[model samples]
Target: MSTEKEENQVKSKKRVSDHGEVFTNKREVNAMLDLVKQETERVDSRFLEPACGTGNFLVEILERKLIVVEARYKKSQLEYERNAITAISSIYGVDILEDNVIACRDRLLGIFTKYYINHYKKGFNEQFLKSTQFILSKNIIWGDALTMKTIYGMPITFSEWSAVNGSMLKRRDFQLDKLLENLEFDNSEINLFSDNKEPVFIPQPVAEFPLTHFLKIGEYE
Candidate 1:
């Protein structure tokens, strides 16, 4: 039974690789993590694997996130294992293939499940799965990063576009001297490399802004 399960996993992995997905090597990951620490930035748990085959990239990300959370709480291996539920929810993954997607989600759940047992001394709860919104449809999209200009699933609204009073309206706020006048807009996603053939999407973590939750304007005030 164990051999059959292992073989099934191997076949599932192949489905993702066939689609030109390349998981990052361990060597490159270690070097990058070193750089990240040297730079000393608060990294987000939201990581994208452009070619996440069987979730190799997510596994590393999960481990790193756990380390960070442990550092935050000053926990040992025992304490870390005890608080695994909260740790597992932070790391996320995206894969193009159906089987790969399922595998990635399942593995992450397994990580959290063991944590539940460690903490509560029991198995996973059914309600926990419903609560974990880690894997979203848009999160793991099936598209060519090169050709895909904009993320189609999520819509950009006027509220997402902000300005300093009427300065943006007069094209004075952002110093749009470089951008074409025709391309100027009061509301947009605020592209960084507008003219570059390959656009870059870097996730920023803001302290006050909560994790992608809906915020009513009047509620905070």
Candidate 2:
């Protein structure tokens, strides 16, 4: 029951030729994500799409996570906001095209805003929205994933946002190249031992910021 025009898989032939851009349709996207249904539904599970184009995949993941967040914590505005932020913070994307990157961010933000406004309407907090925008600006990158650098030719640094003491968030910046460095080491080689005696490779953060209240995080640099 689908028409070719309704599919909207390719933006244009020029884009396909220039960037090899071909978006996955909704049906296919859902089918692939269903393989990891549990992770998609998890409120805090992290997902990174290196070649995300207009966020066809990332938006679906956020919607699934938000559903769980709503079902569990919708009664409490603070709780919903906290868990919602967790869901958004965990979803990341990188697109080589500037226009695609911008569209992806907007789509993800629109989905989040729709759910939020539907639930709380006029009661929604402005600070929470600002925090979400700030997190998205960092999580969604405008760069070449293959090079692990931004369009400006600088190393691509991602902020790891961890919630501490319920309301405070701790942010640590890690370079994309450094984070991928662990792949070079053999998994069988036990380079470091974790608390449970499990092998772990912990990459050092390039920068760490002071703990800031989740709602006020946007105010910080």
Candidate 3:
């Protein structure tokens, strides 16, 4: 029943040849994400797309999570904003192309803004938008996933945003390479085990910031 143009899948033949950047169509993206429907609906569940070209997958995931956020928290603007922040904060992406990264961030922001406006209209909080933008800038990376490094050859770092004491958010940064290394080792035969005999891989944070109010998180950066 959907009527999206096939031409939208690829920006150009050169991009396909140069970067192999054919985007996943909406129908296929939905089909694939339906495989993990529950996670897509969970606001705080984290997702990372290594080659998220304009965020076909991430945008769908955000929309699904925001629907849930609205259904559960729409009555309270504060609660809606907090859960909305959590939803956007948990979605991450990486693209080698700078343009793709910028577009992906904007698309996700637009979705969040649209939903917020639909619910709050004139009461929309500017600080919430700023905080969401800050989170997107940190969450979506302009980096090579294979190399686990940014365009400038620096290690790709991601921030873990956790809501604390209701309105406060705690941020911790972890390097992509280190996280993947531990994840791989954790799944190997010689897996690391916690005291309770459960497999665990606790990655050390590169940096941690003081707890800041969710709406004021951008100011802390």
Candidate 4:
């Protein structure tokens, strides 16, 4: 019988043949991640892995971000926790396989909780844990990237989460297709790489919410 670790891995040959799923090994994952080392360390830098198989890239990225968070905000536990949650929110992942999506979410949450336990040893904040889990549910989604629709056949929409003015959280939703289209460079040569060129794609918000705290998102209906 395959060990649980082997079962959860994204590298099974049969899975590859069936789903085109081949996860990056640690060495390659580190090498590629090092290329964007700076961004990986920045707590608020948004990263999306359209094919985030069991979260190989997102896990590494979160580890790096948490290291930076520890160095900067360890003295203040609240600040560190908030920034850590922001780091989790900034990562987005999508995988067509429902199993992969579930595994990825659990893996990332485990990583965050492990870090939290090590730093804040005395108390268990159930609310904070729930809030983080909620963020992960929004950030890591199950969907087909090519079709740009969720497993349930709805348009894939991502909620952009931000902590504004300290402790007040804000969320704005945007359709995946529009977000991708807006990111593409314009065909017009007039403003190619112009320093003063206008922004290519400004993602118009589909829905906006102002929450007193991250945990309140679950209650917002």
What is the C-alpha local distance difference test score of each model? 0.41, 0.86, 0.87, 0.82
- Give candidate 4's error at residue 98 in angstroms: 0.5
The digit string of per-residue lDDT tens for model 4 on 40-103 reads 8889888889999899999999999999999999888889878988889889999999898999
lDDT: worst 10-residue window of model 2? 189-198
- Candidate 3 clashing pairs? none
What are the TM-scores, per candidate, against the unseen true structure? 0.46, 0.88, 0.88, 0.86
Error of 2 at 52 (Å): 0.7
On residues 54-88, what C-alpha lDDT tens digit does candidate 2 reach at each position?
A: 99999999999999999999999889999999999
Off by over 4 Å in 3: 1-11, 182-198
lDDT leader:
3
Error of 4 at 110 (Å): 0.4
Q: RMSD (Cα, Å) of candidate 3?
A: 5.6
What RMSD value applies to candidate 1?
Answer: 11.1
The alpha-carbon lDDT assigned to residue 80 of candidate 2 equals 92
TM-score of the candidate numbered 3?
0.88
Cα shift from native, residue 206, model 2 (Å): 0.9
Q: Write the per-residue lDDT of candidate 3 for residues 1-221, one digit (tens) a residue.
A: 43355455445766888888888899999999999998889888888899998999999999999999999999999999989999998898999999999999999999999999999997978999999999999999999999999999999999988899889999989888877673533442321112234454657789999999998988974
Query: Can you write out model 1's per-residue Cα lDDT over 97-172, one digit (the tens) per residue?
Result: 5666667766655654544455445433444443332323224344333433223542211011122231121111
> Whose lDDT is higher: candidate 2's or candidate 4's?
2
